[model samples]
Target: MKFAAFSGVFIAHSIQEAMKLTQKLGMDGIEIAAREPHLSPTTSAPRIKGIKALAADLGLEIPVLAGYMGGFSTASDQECEQAFDDFNRLLDMGGELGSSMIRVAPGGPNAFLAHDYHYAKAAHWLNKCAEAAQEYQIKLVLEIHNQSLVETVDSSLKLLHLIEHDHVGMIHDAGNMYITETDYGRDSIVNLGKHLFHVHVKDEIRVAEVGAPGTFLNLTHRGEEGFLQSRLGEGAADHQPMFDALKEVGYNGWITLECHAPYPAYERLAHDFQIVKKMLSWEHA
Candidate 1:
């Protein structure tokens, strides 16, 4: 396994700056955000190539395209067609940047409506997207996020099973599954162990008075209500066990550090990278 960081946390800076920061933090690779203020394949080809060249010059690899943002759940026919066009464009960009995987989300208001509806939409589009990805030798890893249709482990696994394609996989994010009421954390890795193509390490804390529903907070806020980002080893997530589980299952993909740690983004990201490296028993590769 290798270490990488998401560029979105550092979106306030330029893509080059973000990449340089990741390299300076002693990370092995980077997951570039494919959105505005970053490198969107739709509008920036020359810039994308330049960024790819810069990473290669620094002896760093672009393991995944982290910002292929678009949703197709409620999109009209034209919107859906545009989504496919965008998907193909990103696959081309992934090839140009030497990345074999692209991260996407299940977009649509319906995602929040019902499980069966969301899962069906996701399966249909993912399969169609996977067909395009297969042509470019790129895998589309659907990220398990809090707002999307496949927010939980079981849902994500079911979606993957429905897609039923080798070019489609899952991204297990610790923070997204951090809830006080359930043990979805352990089940996430265990159930989708085989289809995990990428990993996002984040932590959250749930705080509430006894007998009350605890408010989830990320490590960054520490004291805020609801979930907030946190530094590694300081939040509710026990990442060491998760790392061990990944190792047990022989997961060799890139483990990208998503530094949602608030305040002093650079320093916090550096610290998070080091913590994850130690937990994964990672050395400079």
Candidate 2:
């Protein structure tokens, strides 16, 4: 697997600077956030080509374009149609930027899947995205994150199976999956198996508990969402088995470092760049 950096790590930074940082750190590629200061569907086509030209000049690949839209499982048909149009624009941009994968969430905060928000909604929507991705000749990846309909492997598979498109897949996020009742990362990777298309490398350390052993707090019972920013291996999440499992599955895809801690964009991601390379056993080679 090759290393990549998520431009979200350098929030508010210019895409030119992000590209420079990625090149400086020797990351194989970058996955830019589909938002301001990075990119948006409405971003001018010339600017998109400029970004692509810069990546080529720096010898960095633009592999993924991550979108932040959500609420599919709960949004009304009108909302979904708007999102579909937004995704179409993104698909067009990804093709222009030479990105092979376009990342999106099934639904983020307030998904409320437990309250009659069925997988069918996500599946139907992703089927549409799959069609768009096919036209773009890129894969549609669902970022496994908390507060989304497909936060866990089971739920993720439920949606992927329903879509049943070759252009659709999942990107594993260990930090996001840690709080979903973790046994390290074993079960999480097991469920993903060969369905995994990309990996977001980060760590989480859970703190602040309410009940006793064998009992855990539900999402509502949790104190705050602070555990997600833990430093590499300093958090409750152990990623060894996760790496091992991916290797077992022969997952040779982009492994991007998402540094939220060890703060100040460059310093943190620079440190994490080494950490992730080691995890992939590239410490020396």
Candidate 3:
């Protein structure tokens, strides 16, 4: 698996500076967040070209352009239509940035959002995205995230199988289990199988002692975001089994670090970079 870092974690750093840091740290690639202060859909054409040039200059591949296309599944028809339009803009951005895989969410509203109709609507949106992305040669990677219609292996596959579009794929996020309490089934990687197009790696432990499900998901601060802490083997998420499952499936793809490591982003990001590199090596060895 190729090692890439998501630029979102370095929110304080400029996209160019973050790419410099990523390259200096010896990462193979980066998953550029197609958001503000990064490479939003509204980013200028020259800036997009500069980004592609920068990646090439640093020998870093931009595999995934992760975006926040949330709440489409459970939204009204108008909202879903707007979400699809937003996804098209992201796909256009991805094409300009020289990246093919763009990350999106099968967002749903409210708890108990899981339903056949929800799955079908989400699939319809994906199909629209796939149809639109064909011109850009981009693939819309649906991430396993909470409040999403296809938030688990079972739910995700149930939705994807209905689309029959190759441009629609999956991203397995192990850290997501902290939110989706029942996300892990018998064998997630085995279940994901061929359709597993990408992966996001992050380690998180419970913030509160004996925390309930979705307990750690709450923010301690305004922009606290996700993850209490992150280290490879020492964290709450068990990655070895996940990697072993990848091996079993012969899956060789981009395993990105959506870095959420604490203060001194450089230190934590650099440390986890090596940790993931070692993890991938050991897994393949």
Candidate 4:
């Protein structure tokens, strides 16, 4: 399986630095975050070209561009059009960067309480985005993240069914799934089946208890009380079963590390890379 590092972790550094560090860490690719200090909707054409050339020069793949656009689940007609317009820009940027896929969010921050109609709205726009992405020969992978309508496997599958587009798929974000109390192992991978287009690995552990008020604290999800980021294998997340499930399903796609531990950037990435290498037995290879 191909391995990649999410550039969001390197937001403090320049895109060039992030790429170089990713190569040094023994990752095959770097998933660029389509945001500031790296890229954005207003990024100049010349800059995009420069970034692409540098990636090629460094011999690193731009597997996917993690986008920050969402709100399909709760937007007015005009707002929806604007969001789609922005997505079109992202697709253009992804094509220019030689990325095979673009990450899309299912809904806005409060999508956990989204109604059935809200899900339909997100699905409809995703279908449109999928059609547009096909022209660029790129796929749109929805993120199964907390606070989103597709946080659970069942919900994600339902949205995919609604979308019904060949180029549309989903990313199994195990960390976020853990926050939402979704199955993040064999059952989830098997149930997603052909719809699983990508994977994100990270670890989090509960740090506080929920009281009667039940107010969700920062970094906590609806299903969980409070949590903090932890290194791979050092956290409560059991990645072995998840990796075994991926192998069992023959999923040879990109497994992007989204490490967010408290350690220094390079140390955290390098350490997590070693852990993943051992899990996948790539160290021997």
Question: Which candidate has the highest TM-score of all?
Answer: 4
Relative to the unseen true structure, what is the C-alpha lDDT of residue 274 in candidate 2, on a scale of 0 to 100?
71
Q: lDDT tens digits, residues 135-198, model 3? A: 9888888887655665578877787888868778888888765455544432888878777899
Q: Rank the candidates by TM-score, best first.
A: 4, 2, 3, 1
Clashing pairs in 4: none
Model 2 lDDT, residue 4, Cα: 89
Provide the overall lDDT of each model, using Cα atoms, as 2-decimal numbers. Answer: 0.73, 0.77, 0.74, 0.83
Model 2 weakest 10-residue run by lDDT:
212-221
Off by over 4 Å in 2: 108-117, 209-228, 283-285
RMSD each, Å? 4.8, 4.3, 4.4, 3.3
Q: Which tens-of-lDDT digit does each residue in 19-78 have in candidate 4? A: 999989888999988899988777899999998898898888999999877678887878
Between candidates 1 and 4, the one scoring higher on lDDT is 4
Reference-based TM-score, model 1: 0.87
lDDT of each residue in 45-117, candidate 1, tens digit only: 7887788789988888998987555576655667767777887888888898889899876663323344576
lDDT measured at residue 225 in model 4 versus the true structure, 0 to 100: 65
Question: How do all models score by TM-score?
Answer: 0.87, 0.89, 0.87, 0.93
Candidate 1 residue runs with Cα over 4 Å from true position:
108-113, 179-186, 207-225, 281-285
Give the residue spans of candidate 4 off by over 4 A.
108-112, 209-224, 283-285
Give the TM-score comparing model 3 with the true structure, all chains together: 0.87
